[model samples]
Structure formats: C-alpha cells, structure tokens
Target: MMGGARVRQEEPSVQKEANSWVFARSFRSEEEAVRLANDTPYGLANAVYSVDAARLARVASQLKSGIVWENCSQVLFPSTPFGGKKGKASGFGFEQGLAGLKEFLAEKTVVGTSRPSYNWQIYKKA
Candidate 1:
C-alpha cells in the first residue's frame, strides 16, 4: 500500500520512544526497504525476516540500527550489547556485552561473544 511512502509516520511505532508496535509495509525491493528503515532517526534495533542468509546479511549490514536481528526480534542476551545509535534515540553507551564492560572498567575489556551462543537454525526455514 505504501508507494514511495513518506518518511514521516504517525503510527505509534515511530512516535513513541520505546514500543513493541510492529510496523509492516510493502516495498518493491530490498533497496526500498532499507531506505524506508534508515529514514528514521532512531537506530536502536531492527529485524530482518528472510530465508536467504546472503540477503539477510546484506540487509542487516545496511540497517543503521545499533542492533540488527536476523529473522529475530527482541532477542536479548547478557553477552550482547543492548542499546541504540543516533541523535535522541541513543544514550552514552551500551548496557551489556563488551560495551558494558568497557563502561565500568578503564584498563581493557575482554569478552567472548565472537561466536553467538544461539543457534542460527532457529531463524532458518525448516
């Protein structure tokens, strides 16, 4: 229904600071989708639902959000940094993971999350 839609959305998802409101819209291609997503100043977190891993990686890379979930949303972990990026949408630093460690300490930060703890297959098509 959205044809070269306006970046400004009146919906609660765009209006409210923290919300679970899921925004759904139609797009002609991935490029359009990325454009629509990055249009927002809030770069907190976003999810990409795709069967193609390559496409997921590509789209996730383009998203300006601080956290990008592949085929998953709101998946929290102690080893992962939970925060956002941008003007008003972001804060000083992340609250978890290596970022959090860096916040409390001064010398050096060491955390092992290079390999995600969760299974990638969970998001994949069975």
Candidate 2:
C-alpha cells in the first residue's frame, strides 16, 4: 500500500518517469492492461501480481517494459543489472551493475546451428 497514485498516464506528472506515480486503474481483463501499458514510449519497469504463475509469465513476456517484476516490486540487485529497453525514459543504455560494465565492452555473436548436424528424418514421427 503506497500513497496517492495518479489515475491517468497522460497526466503531466505521470508523463515523466517520476518513479513514484502509479497508473491507478481497473481493467475488465488482463489483455486490456497489457494493451494500455504497451501503448507508451517509456519502457522502464512494470509489475505483475497474480497467483497464477503461467498468467504472470504470459503478461511479463507481453510487456515491452525493460523490467517486469512478478509477484514483487522494486527488488533490485547489483548482479542482476538494471536498465531500460526503449526511448530516453530509461537513459537509453545506462545500465547499473555488471551489465553496465559489459555495455562498454565489445562483444559478438557466432551462430553454429544454421544447419542441423543430425538427420531430421530419424527424429521425425511417421
């Protein structure tokens, strides 16, 4: 239970990332919640509270925010790293923790599974 939370996201107070404002609203369904949440330029952090683990995973995956907490809120760890995904709302690529150090380092990806090594026909069901 926190203090007063703004009801609308469009409010000048909420438009900026205040880190305290909450979009206090009730949705008829979960889809509506996800829809309304994704329709924004800011992708900082989001929290999903549900007893159903599957539902939590589904909603977390659908959310475009940089961080999605399930059954928890504001739980941060230096090892886990904290950062935003899109837009200037999250400082673009300002990460905290090991990830922050990695961001400055160079990295590359090498794909070795372009072609299957084993025969697919063997594993295929008749």
Give the clash total for candidate 2: 0
What TM-scores do the predictions have? 0.67, 0.69
List candidate 2 stretches off by more than 4 Å: 1-6, 106-126
Q: Write the per-residue lDDT of candidate 1 for residues 1-126, one digit (tens) a residue.
A: 122254345555564555645666767899988987777657788888999999999999998877999988889999988888746466666789998787787796665555555545457545
| Each model's Cα RMSD | 16.1, 8.7
- Going through the candidates in the order shown, the clash numbers are 0, 0
TM-score computed on alpha carbons, candidate 1 = 0.67
- C-alpha lDDT (0 to 100) for residue 116 of candidate 2: 60
By lDDT, the best candidate is: 1
